[model samples]
Target: MQPTVQPFFESVTGTVTYVVFRSGHPECAVIDPVLNYDPKAGRTSTTDAHRVVEFVRQHGLQVQWILETHAHADHLSAAQYLRHELGGAVAIGQHIRTVQSVFKTLFNLERGFRVDGSQFDHLFREGEKFSIGALAAKALYVPGHTPADTAYQIGDAVFVGDTLFMPDVGTARCDFPGGNARALYDSIRKLLALPGDTRLFMCHDYPPDGRKPEWETTVLAQREHNIHVHDGITEAQFVRMRETRDATLAMPVLMLPSIQVNIRAGEFPPVEENGQSYLKIPLNAL
Candidate 1:
């Protein structure tokens, strides 16, 4: 059964959060939900998250899962908040433990932080099947945007987070820690290998030249038109282009803050002795 999906765009971070469910069914899953953040103020608010919550409530949807395609570096996750308000298991790829361990050292997080992928309610392995109401879903371990990126395949629609973007925009950057251009090319092949008509939903869209942001496209369109890796592009060609392009890019503005919070499934870092939660910014550590 094809799942019905609703997209909620958070423009500040250019993130697309999705609410997906089976037709005529109350059970649903929220994907990549965002929590609004004011970096200048060092504060987070749930206004964007509430919009999703409102939609679920208005539609009388039952949220069975709050899923993350990966630990995002562009925006804070609303998983914990949504799980609190909507009642669902917060889940991600089993490899999140790799992310947790890496960031645990990068951020020098307190000893209390666990690196076993225990922050999430469930850890999904590649090929694992689960149900969202009557809709059957499987997790595809499509890494390389980071070591933990995943794509959720629910029938014909695949929620590809930070994997492939719009045709003109190309694919995700591979310069982040643990990201590999070779691996990313292989992962994109896996995605493009899907049935030509399968719908591939993007997690973020950085529109160009007055174009409107889009979150959905087909496997065929990507194979034909994706500038970075079209049907004939070789693995060597993709890796070279990706590496060269990534070298010119800058680290995401919210990378530091987002990593810490996302590593904990969107929960803020523990309160400090000063009676306030703090996000550390390690000087000169990128």
Candidate 2:
């Protein structure tokens, strides 16, 4: 069965949130939803997430899962928000504990903060099978953009999180902690090895040269035209290209705040006596 997919593009962060289900099926999954954040004012709004809520209601969908492709650094997640409003299990790759440990140490989070991925409702192992109504889905561990990155294979479509972008945009950078260029290359190969016509959905798009942002591509398109890792490009070549390009890139604007909130499953840190939650910025700690 080919599932129905509705995409909500958050232009500020160029993130794409998807609501996927089968036709005439009430159960669905929400993938990579974004929560609006204004770094300058340190305020968060649900304006973006509300769009997803509206869609679910309009379709009479029962959200079975709020899925995170990974602990995103470029934007805050709305998994918790969507779960609260729409009801679902919040899940991510089981390797998220590894990511949580690394960031916990770097940020010096509160002593009570656990790095065991307990914050999320469910942790998926590679190839684990689940269901979104009648649609069969599996989790693919594609960890290069981050140690915990996961891609969801639902029906004929795969939600590739930050692993490969539009063919013209190449692929994801691997300079972040726990990110491995070689592993990313291998992961991409695994994805490309899928049937050529398999649909691939991007979690984000950074369009260039005045083109409108696009979020869908095919395995054949990526295998043939992805600038950084087309068929003939070797693992060594991709590693070199990825490493060199990653060096020239700047840290994402919301990396600091996004990590803090994302690592906690989209909930703010516990409020202090003053009744305020704060995100820490460890100077010179990247």
Candidate 3:
């Protein structure tokens, strides 16, 4: 079986959302979709989501699912918006309940907010197999970047979310809630163990100045050559480097607002009692 994937690069987030289909089939799945929001303007637009919809319509691909690798901290998900426009069920990891539990306290959400993960249609489990067209994927529960992170391995390609980045960027940080440097070390090893030629599609990448965006690479290349945490990099060394780098890093530009929306399958917070939607910010809270 063969798969066809279209990667939509969001320049704002440096995240790649893929629309993938089976050879000779019109059914498809969308991974990591983004909703276009401008904080400066406080308005939401569907430019990004519409692009994927038009592509699906142009190709006559029936979207069956909208999947999120985890609750993202960097961008608002377009999953709900796309579901409204395109018709599909949205899914996330079973451990999203953990994320919901933690963030609810952080944001002081009402007790009515369900932290049990009923928000999504499917709470996928590790090693569970699902299909997108003719391509079958096994959920690899790789959780170090986030407790709920799951990499979907379909045929020769692995949608590795933020667990691993493009080889040049090394991997995702293990400092977030439920994230662990040592755990990330073990999780990546599982991915690298795939066949040498397996394609690893990363969730995000911040290309160096003047360089073009690079978001896809091979597992063998990462196993042999990823500069930060490749085969030879020890767990101790990686943890140390990761800690040092995270110390200097400011939280993601969109962290506070994004997580609150994303954990609910990309739905915005309640329209405030003031009759407006507001994103809460706890100053110095990261």
Candidate 4:
């Protein structure tokens, strides 16, 4: 069955959150919704997520799930927030535990944070199949961008989080914790192995100046012309190229604050003795 997609653009975050519903059923799934967070002010808002909720309500859609392609390190997820409002479970790749384990030590977080990935409602394994509204989705463990990265294949659209970027912009950085250029090459190869007609829906896009951000493309197009990870590129060549490009890249603008919050399913760290939750910033730690 074909799916209907509603793309929600978060301007400041430059991320595309999609509301995907099976064509004949009113049941819907929300993918990678963003919770607006202002790190400078240490404040969080429900505006973006609420917009999605309002849309769901208006459409009389039964919220089936809040799907996260991976544990993000750039923006806060609205999964829990929407889960609370809509009574849907939050799900992510089972490998998210790898991310949780890595970041727990990196941030020197407290003992309370569980690395088993029990924090989310469900953790999907590679090749796992599930359904939303009559449409079936299979999880493809697409690591290398991050340890837990996944590509969700639903109907003709594949929700690829940070695995590939718009052609002109190239792909995501393999410099984040657990990211590997060599592994990324393998992941891209796996993605290209899909039906060439598969639609690729990326998690985020930072468009070049004078252009609007785009979140969707075709695997055929990527295979033929994705500048960085296209099909004819050798794995060693990809690693060399990816690393060189990453070296010149600055960290995600929201890296420090985003990771601390993201690993916790977008919830801010618990408020301390002073009654204010705190996020850690490691000096010269990248």
Candidate 5:
């Protein structure tokens, strides 16, 4: 069955959150939900997440999974908040342990902090089969932008997380810790290998020129028009282009804060004796 997909665009971070479910079923999965953050104040709000909650409640849908495509750097995840409010298992790629370990050391997290991926209720393996109600789903390991990145295939639709953006925007940068441009190229090829009509949903979109934000495209469109990796683009060429482009890019504004929270499954760092949570910034450490 084709799942019904609803996208919510968070403009501040150019992140797109999706709610997917079967038409006649109540079970649904929420993917890459955003948690609002104000860097200046180190504050978090649920304005965006509430929109998801309202939609779910209005549709009488039960969230079966709160899924993370990867531990994102551009925006904080609303997985924890949505799980608390809607009651669902929070899940991510099983390899999130690698990402968690990297950030845990960088942030010098508390001694009790674990990097076993236990923070998430479920950890998906490559090609792992699961379901939201009767709608079938599978996890595809699409590491490039990050070691633990995953794209979820629900029926005929694939929620491609940061692997490919709109054709005009090209693709995601592979400059973060453990990111590999070659791996990204291979991953993109894997995605493009799907059926021509397969629907692809983006995790984020940065509209260029005056184009309005869009999050859905198809395998054929990308294979034909994707500026960076169109049909004739070789892996070597893509890697070189990716590395060159990544070198000129600045680190995302919310990288430090987002990583700390996301690695913990969207929960903030442990509160101090003063009852406050703090995110760290390691100077000169990129």
Candidate 6:
């Protein structure tokens, strides 16, 4: 059975949050939900998440899982917030341990911080299968945007998080810590190998030429027209292009604060004696 997908775009961060479920079923899953953050003011609000919660309530959907494609840098995750309000297990790729390990040091997290990926309710293995109501979903490891990116394949649809963007946008950058252009090329190949008509959902969309945003496309379109890694694009060619482009790009605006909270499954650092949680920015550290 095909799943019903409703996308909620948070334009401020260029992030798209999806609510997916089998038709006629009350159980569902949310993928890549966003938590609103204002960097200038250093505050977080759940307006975006509340929209998701309201949608679920209106549709009589029971959230079964809150899934992350990866620990995102552009926007804060509402996984923990959604779980607390909607009652779903928060999950991510098992390789999140690799990310947690890297950032734990870079961020100089407290000694009590753990890198074992215990923060998430479930750590999905490559090809691991789980159920969203009656719909069977498989986890596909698609790292390189980050070491922990995983796409969820449910029926004919795949929720690709920052892997391949709309044909015009090309693909995700591979310059973040642990990101590799070659690995991303391989991962995109695996995604393109899906059936030609398979529907691919995106986690973000940055439109160009003043066009409106889009977050869904098909495998056939990607293999045929994706400017960065279409059918004839070789790995070496992709790596060179991706690396060069990444080098010219600036880090995501929310990278610093997002990573600190996201690695802890969206929980802020423990409140100090001052009774407030703070995010740290390490100087000269990427």
Clashes found in each candidate (C-alpha, N, C closer than 3 A): 0, 0, 0, 0, 0, 0
lDDT of 3 by residue, 1-286 (tens): 4477799999998989999788678889999999887877767788988999999998998998898999999989999989998988899889999999999988888677899999899999989999876678778888888888988888888899988887777888877878887888888988999988888888898887787998788989998878788888888998898878777777787888789899888888778688987777776666
| Cα displacement (Å) at residue 128, model 5 | 0.4
Alpha-carbon TM-score of each model against the true structure: 0.99, 0.99, 0.96, 0.96, 0.99, 0.99
- Give the poorly placed runs of model 4, Cα more than 4 Å off: none
lDDT score of model 2? 0.95
Over 4 Å off in model 3, which ranges? Answer: none
TM-score of 3: 0.96
Candidate 6 versus the native: TM-score? 0.99
The 0-to-1 C-alpha lDDT of every candidate, in the order given, reads 0.94, 0.95, 0.86, 0.86, 0.95, 0.94
Residues 23-57, model 4: lDDT tens digits: 66888899999988887787889999999999898
Task: Select the stronger candidate by TM-score from 1 and 4.
Answer: 1
Residue 45 in model 4: lDDT? 91
Per residue, candidate 1 scores C-alpha lDDT tens digits across 1-286 of 6789999998989899999998899999999999999999998999999999999999999999999999999999999999989899999999999999999998888998999999899999998999999999999999889999999999899999998999999999989999999999999999999999999999999999799989899999999999999989999999999999999999999999999999899899999889999999999987
State the local distance difference test value for candidate 4.
0.86
Candidate 5 wrong stretches, greater than 4 Å: none
Error of 4 at 132 (Å): 0.4
Query: RMSD, each candidate, Å?
Result: 0.7, 0.6, 1.3, 1.3, 0.6, 0.7
Per-residue alpha-carbon lDDT of model 6 for 1-286, expressed as tens digits? 6789999999999999999998899999999989999999999999999999999999999999999999999999998889889999999999999999999989889999999999999999999999998999999999999989999999999999989999999999999999999999999999999999999998888899889999999999999999999999999999999999999999899999999989888888999998989999899887
The Cα error of candidate 2 at residue 215, in Å, is 0.5
